[model samples]
Target: MKKIIVLLLFFITTVTKSQNELGSWNIINVNMKIDSKINVFTEAQLRSLSFYNQFHYYEFKAGVSYKINPNFSVTSGIGSYNTYSEGGDFELPMKNKEIRSWFQINMKNPLQFITFEHRYRAEQRFTSNGYRNRFRYRIGATMPLNGKKIVPKSFYLSVWDELFFTDKEPYFERNRLFVGGGYEFNKKIAFQMGYIYQFDYKINDESGRDFLNIALLYNFDLTKKEEKEFTPATTD
Candidate 1:
């Protein structure tokens, strides 16, 4: 009986020491089309810990994308991020800010029931500490649950996996997996809510900061209206 009691105590202690917190990430994104082949996108995010009590970070990003064709596009972006330290018994909030510039390429394939997308991005980061570079790749798929496409009044499922790599110490940075459901209000507006699981190599010991991710997206088209084709004057 005593041996079993000791083992139980050890197990409980290990679990308590490794406990992690859950967080929330909320974002708003907008995309505007400049023409048939070009677009601009903007995003803002609020990230929090402890169910929105403890503020964690804020991020703003803007980018331009050029569609090479229906299936492929390239993007370049710049972002500013401010991160705060988690508050605790003796800890105080301090801000660490970073600026990042990135470029990405994306490819898409459409199937009967699902669409698959692949993205590759490279980033150059500037921070108070120093400069760093990182690379990331993500594979994602979306399927409509109620309609043929993610059209108005349609519900959809989205799933993705992303890997992060860096040139700094611990070359492997992190990995993320997300599963979500979204509703398309129209071609211009949509909302998604999901859960994201992230594995961080820098933070050892399964820091289970799995997050609730929420996003509101808006899309706009700015393409110039096509002019009517020139008509030849009819000769009487």
Candidate 2:
């Protein structure tokens, strides 16, 4: 894909920069609550069909990230989902497995009261309905309200907005917006939650689709450190 190639080139360029950009690796767990309504036109025109047997999904993902430094990181992930319906779905298909990858850059001092990060994600979805790919990018900022005041820098909070696109090759389009929060526990673990909203697909008397998600994250440094340890003296 064109987007994939662009990201790979950008990563190579960043690595060639003089400054060292690396810290550690992180592991995260993600859970998603998703609902979708699909319509299949009996006729090929696709305008003569009624929506039926909406699909619902509960997805769980395992993600791993490689930090290039304090400013950037790339993550890879995979997800498995559970389908909630089996009726009126003979013609339509649903989600099966997905591939997730993303690149993120942080633009702020680690000690600053606030920090911002840009994240780009691409997904390969193989569902019963069809195989589709999607791209999403997020603008996020972290506020260290308590991290600045607490010893050992143990706590922080963050908020983010995700903008997504689907079917960009044949016809470009926007998908949804995600608003979310992150809460840190100690230095190695964190919690996150969010709501997702789909736009411009409105129908009278129906609320738009939304998701309530929760995630657990574990992050730490992995850079090689110089050896410097003071040994205790032995008395003869």
Specify the highest-TM-score model's number.
Answer: 1
Per-residue lDDT of model 1, residues 97-162, tens digit only: 689999999898989888898899999888755787889999989887776676777677778888
Assess each prediction's global lDDT (C-alpha) against the native.
0.70, 0.39
Judged by whole-model lDDT over C-alpha atoms, candidate 1 comes out at: 0.70
Alpha-carbon RMSD, each predicted model: 13.1, 18.9
Across 26-115, the per-residue lDDT of candidate 2 in tens digits comes to 123322212111111110000001122333333445544454554565555655544433333322343232333333332333444666
- Model 1 TM-score is 0.82
Quick one: best lDDT, which candidate?
1
Pairs clashing within candidate 1: none
Runs with alpha carbons beyond 4 Å of true place in candidate 2: 1-55, 83-111, 149-155, 168-183, 192-214, 219-236
